[model samples]
Target: MTRFQSKVALVTGGRSGIGRAIAKRLREEGARVITAQRGQDTEFECIGVDFNEPEAADDAIATVMQLAGRLDVLVNNAGMMQEQLAEEMSLVDWTRNLTVNLTTPFALIKASLPHLRQTQGRIVNIGSTEGLGSNPKHAAYCASKAGLHGLTRAIAIDHSHEGIRCNAVAPGWIDTDLNIDFIESMPDPKAFKQGLGKIHPVGRTGTPEEVANLVAWLASEESGFVTGQVWTVDGGRMAKLSLPG
Candidate 1:
């Protein structure tokens, strides 16, 4: 049998990028996948949820429970990032980043905890390398992701005895629509990509599939003992530092 055979997974922001890749991967591994996004789509059992809204987490959880009766895995993959230095960022931008990145995930996990505990399920939080270290023009993004790391650990510590495992996957410089759009908006798109690519020891950006694979494993029985850990899949980006000239 497949690793995730007979499992039910609810993935947030599953319409695109890493979330979409994770949803597809879960389905391929024999899980009945349900997706929640701001827009509807026929590709899967999609539930519309404006994650920016306060009630969206509860609404999405209700939809998932109505469809599957139980949630065996919750992938909190929905998040937003703003590019602004600490000095330039406004309260609105900072609040929005935290709301989307940190608050929403916490709400989703809380809403799903009962069902997850019943099934001995897992929570896989999609974090970022920025959570672990500094980045230019990303104060809000970094802070929010770092907060997620703390939240993930808290969940693991509080619920591990109940058979619910919580872990985080921090990806680095993934090549996704978000990144592509940012690059395309630049004056020299090719140069932007190349310059960004060079920072990674692997000489390339990580793929959504690679991140998805790690998440899948963490959510499955293969990682049954793992909890409260932050796994980094960054192409060695966080391991190297630039030397002084």
Candidate 2:
């Protein structure tokens, strides 16, 4: 049988990048996927809601439940990153990053909890390598992702008896549009990409499909015993402190 046969999944920020890949993979695995994004209409059934808005999380969950009848898996893959030093970062910038990256996932999980409990589902939160270790000019992003890691553990402990699993995936540098744009905007795009690739023990960046595959396994019965874990999918970037140093 297909891993996701008869399963229902909701993917936040499913318009592009990793979220999009997860949604597509879940659907291909026989899931009924409802993707939610801000103002983007996807090929699959999707809802338009800016997660930054007050009512967006609730509305997105309601829309998914209405269409799918139940929520079997929730992928909290929506996040934002701002490049600014601590001294230069404003309260608004800090709050924006937290609200979108951390708070939004909390809200979505809260809203989807009853349904998840009913179905005994799982949650796959997309974190970052930054959450594991600090980097320059990423204070707010790191804090938010770290908080998400904490939240994942809390949820696992609180709901394990109820058969709900919660986990996180901390991806290293992937070649997504965000990274592509960032590199293109640099003076030497090729060097920028090459430098990031060399830092990884695998000697290359990761792909969205690779992350999606891990998520699919976690969301399936294959990973039923796993919970409260933060799996890094960063081409072994987090494995060694210094690569070939």
Candidate 3:
């Protein structure tokens, strides 16, 4: 369980939901975790900053290097999804989605390359099933996550020789706080949840802990040979094709 005894990890948006689970899992496995978030306080070593600002990426890396000295894992888990029709989504909304979901990870990767190269560290990007497919009123989210998927592959190929491994974890309908809130707000929460589970072959949605477990393996040496891959931890949702009932 102490696979990361000597490792230092940076998890963006680690204050809540999927990112929080990732940070907790890494810490449980004996890694010294540093969480970066906007206006949220975490029990772990945290850096409060807005990743939406382009410069925050470099600043966050600098802070991590200063605090931990060596970085072994960079989990780009912070992201936001705004729901709007393609035609209704404004330039600002589109830009915001891409900035947080795609560009922030790019900036972090660029800034961490030197340190990661030194440590032969790994990068685990928290992508989404939306990237692989599409959803109603999710144009911006899908586009940004698709960009993130491409970025993961590019980084894996570009830095493989340097001992850097980049992979993405694409999750679908995880039962996170954000998701729960949205589901509860629906007119028929029970029916909504049941419908979601029915669509997935596993008969249920996934959890943050499940996704974190996959991330831990990918970040650790156990998955040393894996790179440039999009691993879906979606309870087989992506593999199933629905038929008329």
Best by lDDT: 3
TM-score of each: 0.94, 0.95, 0.98
lDDT per residue as tens, model 2, 125-220: 999889999888899999999999999999999997898999999998887888789889999989988888788888899899999999999999
The candidates, ranked best first by TM-score, are 3, 2, 1
**Global lDDT for candidate 2?**
0.91
TM-score of 3: 0.98
After superposing candidate 1, which stretches have Cα over 4 Å from the reference?
A: none
**Regions more than 4 Å wrong, model 2:** 243-245
- Model 3 residue 122 lDDT? 98
Query: Higher lDDT: candidate 2 or 3?
Result: 3
Residue 48 of model 2 has an lDDT of 88
Summed over model 1, clashes come to 0
Least lDDT summed over 10 consecutive residues: which range in candidate 2? 236-245
Model 1: which ten-residue window has the lowest total lDDT? Answer: 236-245
lDDT of 3 at 187: 100
RMSD of each: 1.6, 1.6, 0.9
Q: In candidate 1, which residue pairs get closer than 3 Å at backbone N, Cα or C atoms, i.e. clash?
A: none
Q: How close to the true structure is residue 71 of candidate 2, measured as C-alpha lDDT? A: 95
